[model samples]
Target chain A: MPDTIAPRSADAATPPTPRMSGVGRVLVAVYGILALAATGRTAVQIIERYDEAPVAFTLSGLSALVYIVATISLVAPGRVWYRVAWIAISFELIGVLVIGTITLVAPDLLGAGTGNPFGRTSTVWTLFGAGYLFIPLVLPILGLWWLAKHRPAPETTGASATSTAVTPGASGAAA
Target chain B: MIAWFAGVQIAVAVVGALLAIILGLLGRKPSDLTMGPLILVELLLIVQVVISIVAPLVGNEPSGSLLEYWVYLISAALLPIAGGFWALIERSRWSTVVIGVVCLAVAIMVYRMTQIWFVQGL
Candidate 1:
């Protein structure tokens, strides 16, 4: 008698949650590094000068939060994490662009003196992440590309059956 | 920290990073076999942490905020461990690459630590 396989529900098999493998690992590693870097930079900035530049420091804090969420989203499994990765990565791109433009156009707003409301350019995106060699400028674009490449396959008629058939082989390869 | 000693450690870690990159380019997966250099870098980081704490006690006060230095030191110690955790789970050439990244990060951190200690003074 041959051994039998356990049947899983269509909901379980057909969703096709993307695993953080291959190139995703590199992306996650980079995100994790950025998360740590941003968190550390913001913590030091906030603690050292909360009164000097509340707006700038707060933005730094927010940027750190975004990196942290993106890092987690990339590593986690499931469709929900996939969506979260998109949201976080998109937000990060927006942040870099908006803040980069603000700093470039009105340096004094984020620079010291002149009673600049936004304070000094202390956040990660300031001057397009010049302090960190512009990685902040480029990372989100890469993240977007990676996410697009790993986008879940569209739901199709017979997808459930196809997914069920492919499940074991997928699991085998993953293992 | 003893600036020269810490600099040496950072240099060695950078070299370790290069070795890991070579392994990655050669398509090597992370394993116990490839872990030796990474572990060495981690050990050096641990030593740096101790040196960071002791150096200040011995009158080589960090030029920057002591709190900032401590934070960098503690976080530096964790970088390799974090990379190792990811590597263990991934089990691919990318995992080894991640270790290279971790080493590079550690190198930069040590350089930052040094800058925080020495450069700000000048």
Candidate 2:
């Protein structure tokens, strides 16, 4: 609620702009961790055996990119970043659902990607993120909720360039 | 990957978690008192990294992909410090919770490293 711990000096012409704070901090932290995990896993998978499962590995790489973008957008302020965050989070949700369903219903489809006799390939959203305690599945939903709560006010609905004079901390109070 | 190391990791995580709970109950932020256990865990993790790196070079063939082990070790070693610095910056009670989460994560990672060492082979 409060912009920060200390009281603002009278000369403070602009209100403190809230990029990330309170519950947002926890959200960003989780996103940051997931981004790192996905990045690391995809990097290792691609480097070690890219040819073994190109499709699966590429999906993993895409998932990693989504996580990275979501984390950055969440950390940035203004209406533009807000929209970017929504898009990234929505894409992530769709990816998990599509990948999870395809992996389950049609293992044969991705079997070529695995190349193993059993047709087993693990992506970030495989089995609804069983490997990561379902965080991958649950995170985007929470992100959406947070984004809805933090949507920009009507006056700041313009693009990033036009909202430079807007006070973010004042608007964040609505969140 | 050693038994004692894994045990210590779990113990440190448990200690950090309990400390964080105490701070929550007392309505406290991440002050010096609450951060002590996290600092201790960070120290232990650094020690583990040093030993893991040096032990292998000295012909102690650990049973796992050395690359994976190193990544896990380095990440584990950094987790608490990163959390600590964030807590200092945020100065909120949730910061204490962040430290707790990092400690738990480190514990899980260490366990995974141990499993990698045993199951994956050197």
Candidate 3:
């Protein structure tokens, strides 16, 4: 039996959800790092100066939480977990967009001496996440793409088909 | 915040990154050293934590609040621990690369913490 990440073919064979692929593994690790970075920054900002900008700081904290939840769900092996991860990743996309827009439009709402208000210079979502070249902005979207690629469907036998398909006598190479 | 122990830990981070690259290039992992880097870092961090706690006791740091400095120190420790966790679980060449990058990041964060500790800028 092969691991759950074989490439797709159409001979009535189905593959299990990919655990870690060439790209997915790197993506997961990147998300994990971002989760920690954002979480720490949010925590420090809130603790050091919650009085400064409650709205932005609280949103920062919220992004941190979503990133953490997405990281865990994406990495763990389960159909349900992957779906759950997609939801969190979707939230990240929306969060970055919403937060990114508000900061750009209403800079004064951040107040002076807010310690890098948008945190775009430091966060996973500043300048459309340009500090990370919007990779942080794009990560969750890719995660959803990866998740959607392998999600079980009405026709596919899912992982069970993959194990049998991996036999030496059968076509064994992953796509 | 504790300079001596933190300095030694920076050296460890550099060494850890080097080790990871070497192992990864060989298509191997320092399973032996997988836990080694974290252990050394944690030990040094514990020592640093102790100093941050006792800084007020020594009176040299009376002007600086022990609480905030301690928070920074604690955060410094968590970085490598989380990196090590991901490194061990993945068991791939990229894991080694991730470890190397994390060590580099740790060195920078440690240096920043030391600067904050001494300057104690309000």
Give the clash count for model 1.
0
Off by over 4 Å in 3: A1-17, A21-26, A78-80, A97-108, A115-175, B3-8, B18-26, B33-35, B60-72, B79-91, B115-120
Q: Interface RMSD (Å), each candidate?
A: 2.8, 3.1, 4.4
Q: What TM-score between 0 and 1 does chain B of candidate 2 receive?
A: 0.87
Report the CAPRI category for model 1: acceptable
* Model 1, span B21-61: residue lDDT tens: 77886899986655777888889888877777688788888
Give the worst 10-residue stretch by lDDT in candidate 3 chain A.
A113-122
Categorize the docking of model 2: acceptable
User: Which predicted model would earn the best TM-score?
Assistant: 1
CA shift at B110, candidate 2, in angstroms?
Answer: 1.7
Query: Candidates' TM-scores?
Result: 0.81, 0.79, 0.65
Superposition error at A98 for model 1 (Å): 2.4
Pairs in steric clash, model 2: B63-B121, B63-B122, B64-B121, B64-B122
lDDT by residue for model 3 over A25-140, one digit each (tens)? 65676677677666776677677767766766677788889988998887776656767887899988887786666556665455442323333123445445654446667887
> Relative to the unseen true structure, what is the C-alpha lDDT of residue A170 in candidate 3, on a scale of 0 to 100?
62
Residue-by-residue lDDT tens digits, candidate 1, A1-175: 1111113223235544454657677778878888997898679878876787677778889999999999998877655687998999999999988888887787658545212222233688887776666888899999998876665433345666788888897988888
lDDT of 3 by residue, B1-122 (tens): 45687788889977876786566556665365755775676677778777777765776462333444555566667766876787677677766666666665566556656655665444
Please provide TM-scores computed only on chain A for all of the candidate models, following their numbering.
0.72, 0.74, 0.69
